[model samples]
Target: MGSTSKMKVLESLGPLLVACLGILGCTQAVTLEVKERNSTCIKAELSALLFITYTTFNSTSNVSTSLPDSTSVDAASSSCGAAGRPPWLVAVFGSGHALGLSFATNGSFYSVTNLTLQYNLSDTSLFPQSNGSGVVTVVSSSVGIWAPINTTYRCASPTTIRAGGAAVTFSAMRLEAYMPGNDLSPAESVCTADQTTTTAPPTTTTTAAPAPTPPGTPETGVFSVTNSSGTVCLLAKMGLQLNVSYVSQSQNKTVQELVNVNPNLTVTSGSCGGTTASLVLTQQTTTLNFTFSMNSTTSKYHLSGINLLANWSDMTAPFSASNTSLDYLRSTLGRSYMCNTEQTLLVVPAFSLNTFRLQVQPFGVTASQFAAAEECQLDQDQMLIPIIVGAALAGLVLIILIAYLIGRKRSHAGYQTI
Candidate 1:
């Protein structure tokens, strides 16, 4: 009986000891490589991606159920702004948790449940700058299985990563084919999916089309970008193409480029009247140029210039940029910009949902169209009410005091004469 007991103890100890020894000996230290190229852009700022989301919250991390297959997707790289973050990173667009699986390509399953991910940047080894190399896509498979863990994310299809510290890692695990294009909600589009489905684009008038050039001078919008395939964004409605060029020359600012930075920027003509528009920026060695047009060929009119709309209620507008209380509310309560004021421009989609009046900066809009004057008139009135009341009270007191003093002096003089 003693010998049999000892044998059982040895068997259990042997596997445990081996695993411990392996762990200590393995000491796998992960290394990362950062490649910086002049291709990021010639401008001080360029749009690059940061998140490469794969899994999501409240969803399956099962490599098969979660990942999109090996296919291309017609995703909007950016929203409201051309340089927007990916979808998976935004909780409103997508987020949740699920189990994840890893597999090998050889129809073999290894360990399941060893990998985990967080949509938030966690490690430096994950997102490299705009090197155009680490374009990653999420996928799932059934064969070579690995472990999965729960995590959060913004968008599922994470692309165009910018300078980031946390890098995603898959340790010698192969992936399975996820369906290319699956019918998904806006949130699900962030995850990798088979890119086979074609969805209809939204019907909206946007300011991405090319402007009609006056026969006298052809002003083209130049975008001095680094490290990208030389392509252009055609404001199909605007019939304008923002040409991304490699400018060894100095940059120039066109009317359109000015409007992009400060949508209130304008030369003298056209304005942003719609909910959506595309703005491209370019700099020659010295000059910058931007052009305004509509989306696609559907846009026929070219913006002549921009007019500065008058700020009507300067006094009642935001005090000192914005109210700090509101900003704090947004930060702590997951709300919109708390610090925003009526005087500030509301370009984001959030403000569109609620009917609030705001004057577009005098930049990209016409003087007559964006007529919503500042609403600080009411605030100014409230401020003046107290002062007016105080002035009236002081005047009444002074009059009463003067009358009493005058009467007292007359009485004293009359008594003296008597």
Candidate 2:
């Protein structure tokens, strides 16, 4: 089939695969446990978003898909490494796809040796060709680096490993291997991207005026989700900065990238409901979706969830966070919640958001202008700090004055009746 026709077929089958695998029932976590003679030798837990890319029938373009959350380890086929042999684990998806991981350890440290993905191309409902079952090695490494015995290994950014015509990407990954016990704890060793800095030539100094907004700084603007009748149901105004961590494929190190949400960018889509509303913004390879929910009893609305997906040139697969919960940006109906100060909203282990000059009114509103304002926690805290400090200073001043007055009385008592 032609590429266009093949894509159509795959698109049609997407919903079917979701049903066959019961995506809602699938868990995005995988765990491996190895025991020897009643003692646990290795225990690894991994929770992340996984993506796979491959080619079939000598196609020029690659086919990519995310591994379903329902995938689970095949304990029967997996084994622990011993002596000269290496340890391997196999995970099987309901769609007949299998992922395998091979590990190498030299007592002090351990590393991944290979990542293999197996699929049956003959399954017309999935792949484009009927090439029987094929196995592809997606990643291979000869060097060993993960160290220590009990600490978990964390790579909050996306890491892509490519081998031959296949590639695999793992994001927001946490793994614990060669564990002395069964429980998992905080990781001490973090994988980060390499950085190179260059010294700029010295320049003449000048008087600094009020600094203007930087060239690439995001500007705040009002965005609204409207109902079928054109009535606005949800409104927001903010300058957003998305922070994502990923391993650079070229540098082989993890790096954090901040992406600004251009307020000028058009809203791709949105939905407005009585109790819930959503707005989606897309710019280049990054897409952000913000969701809001209303509390009927309190007559207030709040930012309830966030979903972000980004595809960077330095990485092989897309970095994504789906349905991340949030508890801030709240205000009563007709009132806009405002925070002029910068605030951070941690969406997930791999993603966070920095919002500037945020103002949102997710429910009833009279005009485009803001009504009664509600202060954000950060702004309220900032205001409270000054008041607290002023009160403390006033108390200190009062105590000093009282002590001086008492000292004066004591001195006069010792002096002659002047």
Best by TM-score: 2
* lDDT (Cα, tens digit) per residue for candidate 2, span 356-400: 888877667555556778897789898999999999999999999
Model 1 Cα lDDT, one tens digit per residue, 1-418: 2324433443444443334323433212221111113211000001111123222334211110112122112122211112321111111111222112211111111121112222322222332232223233222111112111111112212121111111222221122121122211122111222134555445555455465353321233212211122222122111121222121111221222111221222111111222122222211111112222222334222322111111112111111111101111101111111111222222221111111122122122322232223333444576789999999999999999999999999988887542
- By summed lDDT, the worst window of 10 consecutive residues in model 1 runs over 40-49
Best by lDDT: 2
Evaluated at residue 130, the lDDT of candidate 1 is 25
- Candidate 2's C-alpha runs over 4 A off are 1-218, 226-231, 265-269, 295-298, 324-326
lDDT of 1 at 350: 17
- For candidate 2, the TM-score is 0.46
- Report every candidate's CA lDDT: 0.23, 0.61
RMSD of each: 24.0, 22.7
